[model samples]
Target: MRSDGTLSLERRRQEREEAKLLVLRKRGSRLAFEWGLQQCVKSVNATPRLLVYLLREVCVLAGRLARGGRV
Candidate 1:
C-alpha cells in the first residue's frame, strides 16, 4: 500500500510473488520461485502453472514498460 491508499503495480506484484513463493517454500521444498520449476512435476498442492506464467509475464511486461519498450 502507498500513501495514496493504493498499491503501485510493481509493489502489488512483489507482494503477490512473496505470497506465491512462501507457499512453495513451506510446501514445495523451494526457497524461491523458479522459472524452470514452472513446468516441473510437483504435488497437486503446488502453485498452478498458469499463475507462474502470468506472474512471470507480468513482471517481464512491467520491466519492458519501465525501460520504455513497447509491449
Candidate 2:
C-alpha cells in the first residue's frame, strides 16, 4: 500500500470475500448454508430450480434457529 491509500485488485478481491463471509456469519449463517451453496456450485449440471429449493430449505432452518426454535 502506498500513501495514496489504494489497494491492488487481488487484495481488493480478497477483502471483499472476507467481508462477505463476515456478513454471512453476522446474519446467523451456518456450515449447512456454506455446504449447500458450495455443493450446488461445484455441480456442472446444477439447475436454478434445485439451487432455489436448497437455498429455501437452508434459509428456513436458519430462521428457525435464529428465532430460538428447534431445528
Candidate 3:
C-alpha cells in the first residue's frame, strides 16, 4: 500500500512537470515565430519568391553539409 501511494505521488509530479514543459515550449515557439515574422516584414524588397529561394538555398547547403561536403 505504501509503495502504491509513493508511485501515485511520483506520477502526479511527473505530469505536472510535463505540463510546465509544454507551456514553456509553446511560449518559446511563439516568441521565435513573432521574431522571424518581424524580420521578414522589416526587410526591404522581401517577397514570397525571394523567401522560397532563400529557403531552397539553405536546404541545399544543409544537404551538402550532411554529405560532408564544404557548403
Give residue 69's lDDT in candidate 1 (0 to 100). 93
Cα lDDT tens digits, model 2, 1-71, are: 65689987656654654555556656765654574467567755444544664678678988999999987
Candidates' C-alpha lDDT: 0.57, 0.63, 0.53
Per-model TM-score versus the true fold:
0.39, 0.39, 0.39
**Candidate 1 lDDT by residue in tens digits, 1-71:** 78999998856765665576667656633234453255334423333543675467668768889999986
The TM-score of candidate 3 is 0.39
Clashing pairs in 3: none
Alpha-carbon deviation at 18 in model 2, angstroms: 34
Model 3 scores worst on lDDT over the 10 consecutive residues at 30-39
Ranking by lDDT: 2, 1, 3
Screening candidate 1 with a backbone cut-off below 3 angstroms (N, C-alpha, C), the clashing residue pairs are none
lDDT for position 25 in model 2: 55
Best by lDDT: 2
Could you tally the backbone clashes for each prediction? 0, 0, 0
Report the CA-based lDDT of candidate 1 relative to the real structure: 0.57
Off by over 4 Å in 1: 1-3, 31-71
